[model samples]
Target: MVHQLAGRLNSIDPQAGEALRIVSYFDVLIARGVGLDGLLRGAALLSGTVAGAEIRGRVTRRDPDGHAPADAADARRRSSPRSHDTWTVWLERDGEPGPDDDMIAERLALGVYLLEERRRPDSGIDAIIDPNRSAAERAVFLARHRTDPETRVRVLATPADAADTGAPSAIVPTRYGLLKATLDRSGRLAPPEPAGLGTWVRADRAPESWDAAIIALRLTAPDTPTVDATDLGAMLLLAQAHDPQAPHEDVRALAALDQRSSDVLRTLVEADSIRSAAGTLGMHHSTVQARHEALTATLGYDPRTTTGRMRYTAAALLLRLIDPITPARTPSA
Candidate 1:
C-alpha cells in the first residue's frame, strides 16, 4: 500500500514524492517526540533541497501560553481561533525549482510548530521587551536566535510621552547580502525622512544594542526620522541615568532656572566660546557674556570655566533626558 502511494505520488510529480517522503519522516519523528532542532534538520536533509531554512514566529505584545509542544496531528486537532504567536517555516533556495511549494511549505510549518512549542520559552520580541526577564535571560535568548555574526539588529522605540501611532515596526533580519544596500537606500526614498532607530552590533551583544537603540530613539530630534546608536556619545550615558522624578542636585538647579536663563547656561556649556554661543542663539555676544556672568552668580560658579562647563553639561544632559519635550529656549526668564 505504501509503495503504491509512493508510486502514485511519483507519477504525479517527482517533487510530490519527495514532499510526501519528507512529511512521512516528520510524522515518524513527531511520534518519537523529537525536538524542533531534530525535526527541522531531518526535513531539510530529506528534501535535499533548500539553501537555508528557519521558523519565523510572530511577536505578540503579551506573553504566550505555556502549553507543552504538540505534534502536527495534535496541532491540527487543537488549533485556536486566536493565537498570540503564529509561526511559519521559511525555505530558501538559490535557483533550483522545488517539487511543490505550497504543500511542502505547509508541512514544514507544521513540523516547525511541533518542535518550537517545546523549544521556545517565550515569544521573541515579548521576551526582549519584558521588564521581568533578567538581563542574562534576554542576552541569552537574543544571542541564541541571532547567532550570525554579520546580522545587524534595529529597534524602534518611543519616549514614554510619545504617541504609539507611527510607521509599523519590523524585527526580521534582512535578506543575506542586501542589508547594507537596503539600509542606504531606505533614507533616500519618498517621504525623504529618517525612519527608525538602528544599531549594528555583534549578535552576542543584543541586549546592549537594544539599550543603545532605545536611547538613540529618545535622543533623536522630532524632525529626524531615524537615529543610529553609534552617533550618540555622552547622551547615551545620560539618557540611561535619567529618572524624571529623581533629578540630581545640579539638574534640579538647572531645571529651576527660567527658560532663557537655562538656555543661556546650556548654550554656554555646548558652544566653543561665548561669541559662538551668541551666534548660535542669535543673541548679542555681550548679552550672552552678561548672562554667563549672572549664571555664575546664581549657580556660584562660572559656566565658562573648565569645571563649571563639566557641571553645566551634566545638568543640560539631565534636563534633555528628563524633559525632552520642553523647548530649549524659554522667554519667561
Candidate 2:
C-alpha cells in the first residue's frame, strides 16, 4: 500500500519522506478543490504554524489551530510562480527555515494561483474597467454582454465573497493600488466591505463611473466603509485635484497629531456641541473642552469655528486621500 511504502520511506530517509508527504498533502487538497482559506489552513496545519496569502488586495490567513487571527504576524513569504507577481503566500514561523519550507511555500503558492485562475470570469468586466481599452472596444464588450445602462461601478479594498450578491467583478489596477471593481445593478449603497460606489451611467460611460468609484474608495475610512459618488458632490473635484505627494501645511499639521488627538479632533468636527463630542468620545465634557482648547492651540486654529471647521474638514479629507490604510501595488500585468 502507498501508506506502507510512505512509512518505509520515512524510516529510510526522513527528509525525502517529509517531501513526499508534503507533495501528497497538497495533491489531495488540489483534488478536493479547496479554496484559498482551505489551502492556507492546510499549509498552517502541516507546518505547525500560520499560513497566509495576499491575492491582489485581499489577504487571508490561518493559524495552525485553524483559527483566523485578526492581525498578520511576521512571516517568510514566497510569490506565486504562475501569477504575474500578483499573489504571494507566506508561513509565519519563528525559528530558522525548515528543510521542507521551500516545498511547502511552492505548493501553497501554486494552489493559490490555480484557485484564482479558476475563479477568474471569462466576461467583459475586465475590458469594461480597463482604462487602456478603447472606448469603442469597451462599448463593444458592453453590448456583447448586454450590460444594463443604469449599472454603477464599485471599487473595494477587498474582493467580494459569497455573501455578496452575484455581480460582474474584476481586479482593477489603479494609481493607488489594485482594487476589486464590481458592476452593480442593485443601486444599493451599503456594502459589507469598504467600497467606493460610483455614479449610475450607461454602459458606454462606465469608464467615467469607474474613475469616480476609485476616488470615492480613496475617501473611505475605517469608520466610514462605503462612500457614494452622488454624496460627494463638489468634493470629488477636490479629491481629483489633490496630489498626495505634496503635503500642504494644514495636512502636515493634522498628520502630526497623535491617535488620541486625532480621534478627539474628528469627534469635535462632527459633533454639533462640545457636550455631544464628549458623549461621542466617551470622555467628560470638561475633559473634552480642555482637549479641544489644546487641539486649537496645537493646530493654530479653533476647529469649532466656522472657518476653522472648513479648514479642518479639508485637511482631514486630504489626509485620508493621501494615506490609504490598505497596502496595494502597481499592476504587473
Candidate 3:
C-alpha cells in the first residue's frame, strides 16, 4: 500500500521529485511498520536535511475519520487555495506533513493555480508597479541624473574610446572577441555594480525589498549558474540510487561516461596537462592540436595564459556538469 501510495504521489508533481526521494529514502522505515509517528518523523528529518529546508515533526494521533490528522488537513488547505506563505517562507517554515502524502501534490497544484491566476489578472506593468511611491522616486532620481548641457547633449553616447584621451584606460573584450568597453571614468570600481539589481531598488533599502538581497539569500551562490533543478536532481538521484554509499567513485565513473570529448577535456584540465590530454582521452594528437589551436582562435588568446584559463574554466563547467543530488527540494505542510 505504501509503495502504491508513493507511486501515486511521485507522479503528482515533477518539481517535487526531491521530496519523493526523501519519501523513498524513508520507505524502508515505513515498511518496518515502526508506527505512523516514527515514520513521519523520520521522513521529516530526512526531507528537511537534504532539501535544505524544514518539515513538520510527527503527529501523535490519527484524525477521527481514520484519515490523515487535522494538522495535515489544515496544511493541505494552506498550501492549496489558502497558501499564505510566500515561496521563501514556504521553504523556510517547519510545516508538518499531512496524514496523506499530499504535501508535494498540493504544492505543485498551488504553483499551477497561482500561475493561472497571474495570467488571468493580466495586469501587466500596473500589477508590478509599487503604486505608492515607486513612480515618484523614479521621477526624482531621473530629475537628478538628467543632464542638460548647453549644446544639445548626445542623448545616447556610443561608448567612447579613451586610449587617445590619454587617461589610463582598460579595454574589455566583449563576447564576440572584440574590445567592448573602455572604463575611462572610475576609481578602482565601487565594488563591482552587482548585475542582478536595478533602479527599481532603493539605496537605503530594506534588504527584503532589494533584488540583490532577496536573490542573495534564495540562491545557492552569486554565480551558482541556473539549472533545471528537476533534471539535475533526478540525475543525481538515479546515480545515487544505484550506489548511495559509493558516491565518489560512482561519480568519477559517471563523469567518465559523459560525452567522450568533454570527459577528456575535464581530465586534461584537472590534471593540468595540455599535451597528452588528447592521447589519454582517445583523440588524435592532430585533433587535439586543432582543438587547442581553435580554442585560441575562437577566444582570441593563448590557452596557457590567465586569459586562456578563463575560457578553459567556462568550458570545464559545461564538461564537468555535476549530476544533481536527485531532487532539488523536499515537501511537507
Candidate 4:
C-alpha cells in the first residue's frame, strides 16, 4: 500500500514523492535502532554526497560509498540548524543540490537528535558529585551502582573529552571551569595528559575527593602532567590559603619571570645540587649558575637555600592555582 501510494504521488508530483521516500527511509532507520554511523551512511546514499555530524567534540563523516573520507572539506554543503548547542548535521554535495536536499538534511538532523537522546547516560555520576543533593539522595544513587557508603573511590578530573575510560563520568562545573570527572574504582586509571587523580576516599566523601582532584589538576604543569593528591600532603592546606583578589608578592614575582627563567628557577629548587640542576636542564653549569644568580637578584631570595627553596615551591604551586586559562563552557547532553 505504501509503495502504491508513493507511485501515485510520483505520477502527480515527483518532488513530493522524493520527499516522502526520504522521510520513510529515515523513519525505517530510526525504527531499526541504527546508530550514528548507519544514519550518516543512509543520508549519504540518499543525497549522493558526503554526510557528517559533529556531536559533542566528536566528528563522524561518511561518503556515498559508506566509507569515511580522508579529507572531506566543508564546501557546497547544506547544514541543519544547530541542535541542543552540541551537535550539527550536514551534507556536502558536488553540484547544485537536488530537490530533496533540504528534506534529507532535516531528517538526518532529527535522526541524530533522537539517537543522542536514546544513548544519553542514565548513570548518576552527576548526582553523586553534586554538592547540592542531600546525602540520602546521593546514597540512593550509590546503592543503585552497587557502591556502598563506605566503599572507597577516587575521582579523576581531566579536560572535557580528554579521556575515554569506560568508567562512569560526568561534566562538572568547578572554580576552574568545566572538567570531566570520572570515578575510578581500581586506582589504576591512567588518564590523558594534564589530568589529576584525587586521593582515595569513601563513597560518601566523594565531594571531598572531587575538590582535591581539582586542586591536583591545577598543580599539573608541563614537566608534570598528572598529580596525585596523596603526594601533595600538607601542600593542599596551602592551596586553601590562597586569595585570588589579593595576590601574594612572591607569586606575582614568579609570574613575572619569563618561561626560560621560570624553568631554571623550578629546576634549581627541585634539584639537589647546582650540577644536578644543570644536568636536568641540559645547560652548562656556568650558564645555570649565572641564571641562578640573576634570578636570585630579581626575586630578592636565594632559591638554592633550604628556606628559599621552600618559599619558591610554595609560591609556584599557588601560582598554578590562580592560572587564568579559562576552560570551555559546559556542553549539553
As for lDDT, the candidate ahead, 2 or 3, is: 2
Ranking by TM-score: 4, 2, 1, 3
Displacement of the residue 161 alpha carbon in candidate 1, Å: 12
Relative to the true structure, how large is the alpha-carbon lDDT of every model?
Answer: 0.49, 0.70, 0.32, 0.77
Give the alpha carbon lDDT tens digit for every residue of 187-227 in model 2. 75345556778777766677777878877877877787777
**TM-scores, in order shown?**
0.43, 0.55, 0.25, 0.57
What stretches of model 3 exceed 4 Å from their correct place? 1-261, 314-330
lDDT for each residue of candidate 3 in 102-149, tens digit (9 for 90 to 100): 443333223322332334332222122223445445344223333111
Q: For model 4, how does the per-residue alpha-carbon lDDT over 1-333 read when each residue is reduced to its tens digit?
A: 234445767899987667666766776786566889999999999988888888887888999999998884565555433356578878876667776667788777766765664455566776787777877888987886788878999889888536468787866446554577888888877888788888898887788788888888888889999999889999987886777556689998998898999988999998999999999999999999999999999999999998998889889888888764332321323
Candidate closer to the true structure by TM-score (higher is better), 2 or 4: 4
lDDT of 1 by residue, 223-283 (tens): 6666766776765777667665577777878877987887777789889999999999999
Top lDDT: which candidate number?
Answer: 4
The alpha-carbon deviation from the true structure for residue 237 of candidate 3, after best TM-score superposition, in angstroms, is 31
Model 1 C-alpha RMSD to native: 21.5
The per-prediction tally of clashing pairs is: 1, 0, 5, 0
Which pairs of residues collide in model 4? none
